[model samples]
Target: MASPLRRHAKLWIPLAFIAAAAVAVWFVAVPAESDGDPDYRDPTLPVAERVADLLDRMTIEEKAGQMTQVAVDAVQGDAVAERGIGSLLNGGSDALHDTPEDWAAMIDGRQEQALDTRLGIPLIYGLDAVHGNASLPGATIFPHNIGLGAAGDPDLTERAAQITAAETRVAGVHWTFSPCLCVVRDSRWGRTYESFGEDPELVSQMATAVTGYQGEDLSADTSVLATAKHYVGDGGTAYGTSETEDYLLDQGVAELSEAELRRLHLAPFEAAVDAGVGSVMVSYSSNDLGDGPIKAHADSYLITDVLKGELGFDGIVLSDWQGVDQISLDYAESVRTAINAGIDMVMVPFEYERFIDTLLDEVEAGHIGTDRIDDAVDRILTKKFELGLFEDPYADTGNADLVGSPEHRAVAREAAAASQVLLQNDGDLLPLTGEESLYIAGSGADALGRQLGGWSGAWQGTVEGVGEGTTVLEGIQEAAPGADVEFSEDASAPVVDRDVGIVVVAEDPYAEGVGDAGAGDHDMRLSGVDAAAVDTVCGAMDCAVIVLSGRPIEIGADRLDAIDALVAAWLPGSEGTGVADPLFGVTPYTGTLPVTWPARVSDEPVNVGDPDYDPLFAYGSGIQT
Candidate 1:
């Protein structure tokens, strides 16, 4: 008889041969079409000729319409077809459905309407897939960039990006707003987790890797387009200032000098552009360079002169949602300034009609020239041609099963496993046995709404009436089937008497900067009722604390020490169950810290580029079994 290992190898030998034969047969039977044409490079073609060859073939309204992007709820099939809206985006709270099939169907229906247009320019669908296609159900959610920074592996970062791209395309989305290259200088900023690391070099390198993984050749591959976003200094915004007075989380103003800004923040974008990124999204944050915050949107110097000319960027430059509105207090003036500044696409996500009217009126009134419109249109058309949307305007709905398929789930599972950092493990208490009676506490443990975080199912991160998601509680229950389990929010559940207790603590879901910084929102440190909850739970029984958050918070070393084990599971999306693999001994805890944990609130506003830098935990710091 063969040894067990030998037997396993012997069994796979025959199967491997069959797999190879099958692949060869499949490729031979279904050879891909060869549109073997020499590279066509013509820059001198008139914009009218280019758009007309594309547009003359298109009806009157279709040519005028491909320029607009509307929200999913606001658009009808007729409007999408007649107006020639070339793109659709799912903003905050917009979801096709909870399942992958539903998502594919939703996109297929939209694409069908788009093909009905005269020119049949395939509608480009986009979403903020910021952290692992967070909008799609069952899409793997990795730890935000801040956590990845602590892990400090460029190879791992690239793998995460590849997984994100694959899964996003699986969901029928071709464009992803990701790899935010902002070098976060302040933790108080809401979008801190969106950045890879605080170091400009690190952010640049990681951003380039992510862009590469998303693929530069969209024409031949099903890979999605990667966008390096919030172009300029959004992370260096001064505290207490925001673009809108009603929400502290909206676009704010950066306070860096031009030299510092370029040296620290702008460096990553340059790297992204060089990597052949498909698009660049302008930041809403105001800069002091020449004009001001709003001017950055339409500033010819920055958008045209700097980004396009100096940096040699050739991709689409899109504004943030309704970001063009800030160009001026006057609606028409705002449209004119932004267009003249160099915006190629307007995400007039809401009220697109007004934007269209304003742009046309401005041109007729001489406030904005037709040449400027032609320039913007030319850039937009060039990108569409490059993306090969002109030839193939439809997605492969026959492969609809690809959405959230097993392959995607496997990648997401790996990311989820890699992203969790074992912050503390006293007495080596982790890898809880399946037989152990686990008592779970905190709102995050059983709540899917809390686990999904901001920009999911809702614009403002509100989870109410938002539909369904897998919770940490469900995950633990599934991992330890038939094991005694109990949950409580008040810390008074009888399950505390169980053999082991797990307390899952999380911040109220929020996006941008809406979550308060001082009192009500969240403090880096475990304080107020949260601290009280921890203290109460720990005092009642032996326990481990798991933090589910977008950013690391300052927790007293003593408090962290008191818990038997501590895990940083940064916003693990619908697959909260994936977290159980590490918790229940199925997978070892291997994720390292992606960002430093602050020992105190005063330690914050710490930048990796700071001269006097000292951190509670160093970047790339993590504990593993």
Candidate 2:
């Protein structure tokens, strides 16, 4: 219809415009090799290859920085990006006011700075989140490991860890120092509740938490690194041998033969390794295997030859808080020995700058080899790569809503209910029909902090109660709304002739070496205030005593004979309703005693298999109602 040249020009012009737009979209969408991106930045490559590429380009200063972990309060502005801090942690009480979103914002800001560094490598953040994302106030707080050990349900342990991982990731945290696999041999070690039980088999069974935290893949959005903590023999530390002042057993020595160590203590860690745990934290306590006691941080034979070589744990080996300093008074020697002992990361919580400079100097001198530094950096970076930090380092702000959700609390309630161990129920006193006139007495009746014990909101949980939690009294009232419910803190009120009196006694919250009992007035006996309340309530009416404590406390033989019912409510945490569920027949009493209930304060180290194993209640004893 038209001239040949004009018609052909018209078709070619439209086609050329279309081709130009398509080319522009392709360049913007796809990351071509010619875009000058490094192999480490490529998401398509294997994580090992990416780690290798990244490690090859890092400087010695950067490598040392990769092995240094600083506490959150110690970090100054721009220090994270400038010094290339490999990790950051929220040590208890450091940043206690941070909400879930606040934590996410802070972590994301730090991650942004880390990404702005020369290599643009992202940093990882960690927390003590031993029981749920407990550092955050509103996050779900599950029962302590002792309760879980009593529950004896691996599936429940796994579910608790899974929820912990999700909430932690939502807050932009990458790692949790959790699933304390210490098979506690001594109940007076202060961290007794952190252990699963006295038996290696029970502790090993709880190792399913590893699978829960990491999930099937590390790169998943909900996954966070899980640590099998205080590696080898923390719980077996001998009483009165502690280096920490006033601590009777914590940070003491585990004096035992190598065979006994393996048989009693090493089995849980071995199981953790088999579960593919991404990290192992060395204990602050020392181990005596036919030789003088040596700090685990300086024990090359155990960490390197045993944990790495024999156990085949390729994950990063981390030092506990100021753990290396305990090895030697000489800082340089301490650094040298700890590094030589195979500690991949140093938790130089406060003195990060000193640690970084000292580490670099050690590498410059012949004290610590560059190859070892490289190895440490490699292990650290491998985890960062596996965490998918390079591709998506920012927190999923949308997931912040998952913290303390109703669904999570439901699971925690279930775990708490399952963990209730009914020690005595004379004349079928328990499974109360929710129709009794209940008279609740004692400090633990309405105190959430006492029920949570240590590591609830702060390192050593507060007496004023740290986070949101329903108290046992409130749960009792909720369970029986139509019944007459009265609460008295000290039972100083006039005696009421109720159908039943519920007396709640508690051990005040303590963490680490501070909670140690068995030395001078710190014995495991019930506190005077709680005992007085117990006497007043049990004397006036038919009573059921609920002992809310971290470990077994001495309730004298007279008290045991007097009470109609006794329940071991070991740190039920935020979900106090679970404690009521079993009592009101909502759930059955399935939990057994994780540790033996001692007959007296003299039975300090009593356990399942002692030659003189006389206990008030044997290990695994629970009265089914």
Whose TM-score is greatest here? Answer: 2
Per lDDT, the best of the predicted structures is 2
Local accuracy of candidate 2 as per-residue lDDT tens digits, 527-616: 888899889888888889998988998899888788999999999989888899898988899999988888876677888888977889
Q: Write the per-residue lDDT of candidate 1 for residues 176-223, one digit (tens) a residue.
A: 888788887767667767777677877877774445446656653447
- Candidate 2, residue 448: the lDDT equals 89
**Each candidate's lDDT (Cα)?**
0.70, 0.87
lDDT of 1 at 202: 72
Error of 1 at 305 (Å): 2.4
Residue 250 miss distance in model 2 (angstroms): 1.2
Number of clashes in model 1? 15
lDDT of 2 at 614: 82
- CA shift of 616, model 2, Å: 0.5
